[model samples]
Target chain A: MKIYIHTKFQESIYQQFRDGLEPKYEVIFGDGEVSESLKEQFLTCDICYGNVPLDWLNTSSQLKWLQLNSTGLDPYQQLTEYQFQLTNLKGFFGQSVAETTLAGILAVYRRIDELTRLQTKNEWVGTPIRETLHLLHKAKVVILGSGAIGLKTKQLLSGFECKTTVLNSKTISQLADYLPTTDILIATLPETKETIGLINKTYLDMLKPSALFVNVGRGSAVDESALIEILKEEKILGAVLDVTEIEPLPTESPLWNLPNVLLTQHSSGGWAEESAEKVVFFLNNLAHFEKGEELVNNVDLVKGY
Target chain B: MKIYIHTKFQESIYQQFRDGLEPKYEVIFGDGEVSESLKEQFLTCDICYGNVPLDWLNTSSQLKWLQLNSTGLDPYQQLTEYQFQLTNLKGFFGQSVAETTLAGILAVYRRIDELTRLQTKNEWVGTPIRETLHLLHKAKVVILGSGAIGLKTKQLLSGFECKTTVLNSKTISQLADYLPTTDILIATLPETKETIGLINKTYLDMLKPSALFVNVGRGSAVDESALIEILKEEKILGAVLDVTEIEPLPTESPLWNLPNVLLTQHSSGGWAEESAEKVVFFLNNLAHFEKGEELVNNVDLVKGY
Candidate 1:
């Protein structure tokens, strides 16, 4: 069997993959980009590491397995008809992303952004902050998506004494009803057909004026225009968005300057050893595949999570 | 017996106090300020709520009890020789201050301040942030002052799976030994002869280069000049201070401009309903005092916490 490594990683991580797999299989290491040269090698390879364009799925009949480096597999929904088995790094991202979600929530609740503004101008103002201050404790929280992200978020919030209700496939269809009582609504769903644009104006309007909305999931899961309107009117307390409908959110986007919004620039899943962690995840799954055992994070094609 | 309310509060809270204790006792609602007229009334009043000058302790012989609205008893430590009961709102502040301490820690670990700075410039740069990104999970944490504040902080960090060791009077003298392996060091000590200037240069020198030091306790507990020197030299990772030795921190202070420092301007105890909460605490203590029972949160004058 032949394996093609086609992911951008640090030299140390690449060395790890080479040292681990090179002895048993016909291993090929391509410059970690999806260039024309790397595309040619995918034709003869039995297995590949990292994502490829959906078009490549139709041409690569020799490919048996492909491991993705990301948690969200929505983009690959189109290639479900292909013969290759797919796996994603799901559990690895939960801690980093959940911590980011909690950080954003606590930042808004404690008014850290406002304090940072004061710190930069070298001003020490105290009384005005009390008007907008809130506590995460005893909040009625609603977490969408009961996957690793949602479960980890609940466990973390356990210390805060929040009342949490996670909306999975069975419960997500009625999310609008959950918003009226929610003090903090967090979305951690992928960009699946069922989830895309789910948090529309109706649901956003149902939120209490003091409630907070956070999206650590795909931004396509929310209607950005509707969210902006609510934020402009100050209908809701605030928002913390780690992902937006567009990447590198346009310079002119109002989100950058909105006093009520904290945009994290899609860096919620970031960590110091991200590349090394991903390489380790792929290697572990590769070992499972070679042993003909069940892979850990194998994607269910129908769910497209 | 006469009880004087010497704190600013809402009319609703005043009404609540009136409904709670009007027919049996003489209830005087004095202006919030400690004026000459209020001072004269304090001389004959049986009890008072809200902080007064230390000199009032020496002059007011008829004042049987003093109820303070804050947790820190440092300001009143000088009047310990006075023959009156002193009670500070100690346990009540744990939840609010602990949330603030956690907020500061998460902000530093996740670089919320840096992201906010980038958000202001409408920059979407992502790569550089990953180098500084970290999780609160598995951190070696040391919390100073094993009172309500320290214990609550420990409980909150427990969800993050941090290895926490809280240093009270018994263990604080040996804190230097813990610094080398510590990732997060938090001080919640009150101002006392022994604790004052305890986190000086000698202890700071023992910290690992990547360690984070947080002070949500009294500012007088740390030697500000030594902390500033270490911050300037980049000897430690960063600091989050809710209390400073001199507050409304002068504009000329280097802490304002330092990349690693986050100053909260003493808003750690602030919340939306602070006045109402403090009033409720006073009312509860009043009930205890009227029954001739020991008041909750009575200060041990010798230790002055």
Candidate 2:
């Protein structure tokens, strides 16, 4: 069998994946984008991993499955429009992203960046404790999306005794009601047609002045322009953003300079062992595929999760 | 009856306290230091709230009680030298300090300060994820001083599924055994003869290279010079100190320049509503004193915590 590995990972991790497959199958390692040589591999390979061009879905009759390297299915929305099996890397990143979400929120509420700024200047002055210090205990937290990341965030917040309400596609209409009372609004919603630009000015306006907005899922879901304006004017307390509408957030973006906003540069779903973990997951799934067993994390294409 | 309040608070809170106590008692508002005028008031006042000079404890024949505005009994170590009812604010600052501890730990583990530095320079790049990003989940955490702050930190770590062990004075002898394996070591111990300089070179060397040290308790418990050397040399991971040996940690302190150290400037015990809570506690204790009832949070000066 011919398998095409199209994920970007360290050479050692790729070597591990190659060694784990043994001599039974031939493996072609390449980048996510399908070039002419990758196209040749995709045409004859029985399985392809990582992202492929949306238009390349129908290019091969032998392509049996496509596994994604990420949890978000936005890039592969056309999966439903085709007949191939689609599996995503889900459940794995929830812990990493959840940890980042907590890190971001706590960093902001504790005025961590402000202190670091003072440290750089060798200033001994302290932040106005009464005006800045915030306790996470019993806070009203609204987590958007009921997926793995959101649920994990809810579980993590339980220790702080925060009152958390998770909103999914079915109940997102009630978001306006939740915004007014939320002390922390965390968006872990993936980008779909319905979710794009969901956090517009209207939704942002409902939040209290002390409310903190956190986005760890996808950037397309929020209206970044509106958020930037609100942050610039100090309308809300602050934001802890791991995902923005753009990747490598443009150098001139106001979000970078905003004192109240913490930009994590899309590094939330990152850990030292993530590459090794991915290799293990891919190998396990490949073994299952060979045995004719149903693959894990097989997404419902129509639902676009 | 005569009462002296040595802590400064809001005018509205002072008014509330004054109004709560009727014509039966004389109330004197003053500073923590014992000046000539404050000494005169302390001579007559049976109950005083906040700091009093160590030598002046025996000068007041009528002094029956001393109410402290802080949790640490380090400054008033000599309180045991005199015979008087000593009550310090105990459980109140736990949640605030615990929140700060988590914030500091998460910020360090997630490289929040590094990202903030990048943001200041408008750098769109992320820190090397493979070298930095860490999950708080499943981390082996050991908390020292099983008081309200230590216990609360343990409770908060439960949601992250971290293996947390809280050590009090009784079991602190086993600290060497725990330190070697601890991924995160948090100290919430108050200053005492036994605790001062407890985190010396010997104890710090026992920790794993990746271990993070957090001190939210009194600064006297840690040997500042030892910590400074380790931090400067990058021997251990880093430290998150909310309390240092000195307030407004001197401008010349190397901790300000060390990339690994995060100095929160003793703001962990701060929150917007702390003054109100203290006022309520004082008034309640005053009412208890007036009714000849034993006060809550009454400290045994012999134990010095």
Best by DockQ: 1
For model 1, residues A93-119, the per-residue Cα lDDT tens digits are: 898889999999999999998899889
Q: Which stretches of candidate 2 lie over 4 Å from their true place?
A: A31-34, A79-83, A127-131, B31-34, B79-83, B127-131
Interface RMSD, every prediction, one decimal place: 1.1, 1.6
Candidate 1 lDDT tens digits, B1-305: 99888877778878877877758788778757877887888778999988777777788889889998677775676664777788998888788889999999889888899999888888998656775788888899999999888998998887788899999988887798899999999999977788889998899889989999999999988989999999999999999999888887888999999999998888888888877778778888888988899999898777665
The DockQ of each candidate is 0.76, 0.71
| TM-score of predicted chain A against the true chain A, for each candidate | 0.94, 0.94
Fnat of each candidate: 0.72, 0.79
Write out the backbone clash pairs for model 2: none
